[model samples]
Target: MRKEHEEFVDSFEGQLPPSIIAEIKDTCPASVTKEQLKEIVELTLGLYKHCRVNAGECVGLVSAESIGEPGTQMTLNTFHFAGVSEMNVTTGLPRIIEIFDAQKEIKTPMMEIYMKPSHNDLEKVKKFAIKIKEVVFGDFGAEYVLNIFEQSMTIKLNKALLSERGLSSKDLAAAVKVKSKGFNMEVGNDFLTFVHKGKPEEIRQLYDLREKMRPVKIDGLKGITQVLPVKRGDEYIILTLGTNLEAIFEYPEVDISRTMSNDIHEVYNVLGIEAARQAVINEVFKVIESQGLNIDIRHIMLVSDIMCITGAVKGITRYGVVSEKASVLARASFETPIKHLISAALESETDRLTSVVENVMINQPVPLGTGLPGLITKLK
Candidate 1:
């Protein structure tokens, strides 16, 4: 670890998390060249200075205008997997709304899973991706056979397909028994059977059992409906359609430091508020960049800070952080002016007219910058 760099970050009085501190130290280790360390230090200091906001800067107005301007240019097109119309991901404007609104469930919740250094090999990553992909019992069954006389069901496995997916008859049998119980299972070379000795009218149970067993997840991470391993630069990274943050973090082969989910709330819940704040900034910038829009990252950061100021994720919407503004007129300006005015009047809420909007509403000069300095004369 680099002692000077560690001390410099620690000077923030634990404002920075240990993982970030460790990452800095690890990257600029004591063994690294002194010139490199100097460059890193200068970059870190420069970033810190760049992030600091001036006192009386109307950050809210700046952020709103910054993001809102480019947001109007976003397309409403959805990204769908060919041949599977139902597996479309919400992108562009809708995706931005899903993030900033702090919606509990997103249309397409996903994760970019980074593997540990040891598991970065192409074959290893490819196998790992398959292992993490959600596998339902229906994948193994070539044909579902239900005998009316025996009141039993059998899943005839396609030997080639089953073997290709790295599944065996025993695995299929175990999964069927675990998911759909009460029937005695018999595993054979290329088939699995479920026999239930029951009354003739209870044959309806056979159809129900088949339906229940078909969708049962026999293996892989639950909620991760699909996984695509793509090689980026030198290493392989897994892109999953559905997110399972809690479960993915538990795997030892996963590089916890780099593994991040697209769902802001999931990131907030799994990681702390700071991580969530960073996610917001990254996600917003990502969308902007995708549309080839050039906006100052600082504006996005300001918005993120406001959303996470209460130490939890809140949206900029009327029901979220915006509604809790200290100034009543600001809230009113956001949404439902009449409702806000009535509520404020009934509650006897005082508006100090300190902020820009409130002062402008009452035809007073806004107290920002030069306006903040009121002239005073001493009695002669």
Candidate 2:
């Protein structure tokens, strides 16, 4: 890893106690690869950015939805503090409607709130906002909320320092408050003045206190299965649970008795499907082993079901037919390495048969398969 990346990892690593790290390492068993580590870091940073941008908006939504007249046009903008500072609030009726419509797809609902900051009071306004955010979110057990508030303060400060000479720093600070709330305060004679009325500190504080708790961990895959490759004639195919059966048999053969001897259509027939799926997988492995093919057992188990039964592999769509039951069976059988063994065996058959024999082996789909587009009708 680059020095900066390593530093980031170390810093984040330090957040956990040694006991916790040891426990994680024991349970997960060195499962965090370099790629996964990078992904976790990236995800964390993304969440941080998202939270900074949306925390204030969340407060604004609540405020707008609560106080504004049902049909009235209103725009409210203000800086919010939750340990971290953010510019948030709502916009007019049209903008609110736009936000509502966009929310359905984007999952984020926000509208613009205008703020005109004076020269000097800008810093104070920012500081006050940050303090308010910390107090509010802090009540809800969110320790990191202040980080965004602090960042927002730094941003406003930089802008104030770089603006034109006519805008005094004091004037800038005074402008941070919204005037309609009739809220005012004096920090210093020279620096403190009303630029605009700001939202009540109490209201901001209440909103912060009621904000939802931060999740301890994110949702998604903890890890992914490594892709297993199966050679079929001149090409290779990825062995997944959805692999087709035509990929299996290597030569022309009569319709033979199913290796599995039990009915597998019903959900209660777990033992039957399990038995048959395993038998079919074992047969596939026997075939591949006879051919002296070197491949992973896990891969064979991935597509075991399609190779074993007359049913098309479920989830593995062709052009027309969707194998609902077969797909479900395939998915269920290969939940572990044992079933993965069956899946792997099936894939080997698929590769060998399709490549060498040029025939649809077992459950391989045709144009009549479940994945077909448009209407599929049979002529009498």
Q: Over the stretch 1-380, how does candidate 1's per-residue lDDT look in tens digits?
A: 55665666566545545665566777664676657765775677667567666656667777778888888999988777665556677778998888788888888888999999999998999889988888888877898888988878888888986776777898787766766667778889998888884444588887888888878887889989988887788889998889999899999999999999988988989998999999999998887787788889988888888889999999989989988788999899988999999999999999877678888888988877566655222345
> Quick one: best lDDT, which candidate?
1
Span of ten consecutive residues with least summed lDDT in model 1:
371-380
lDDT of 2 by residue, 202-288 (tens): 334423322321211111111111112333343332222111122112212211122121111211133344554564455445434
RMSD of each: 7.9, 30.9
Candidates in order, TM-scores: namely 0.72, 0.15
lDDT of each: 0.82, 0.32
The number of the candidate with the highest TM-score is: 1
* lDDT computed for candidate 2: 0.32
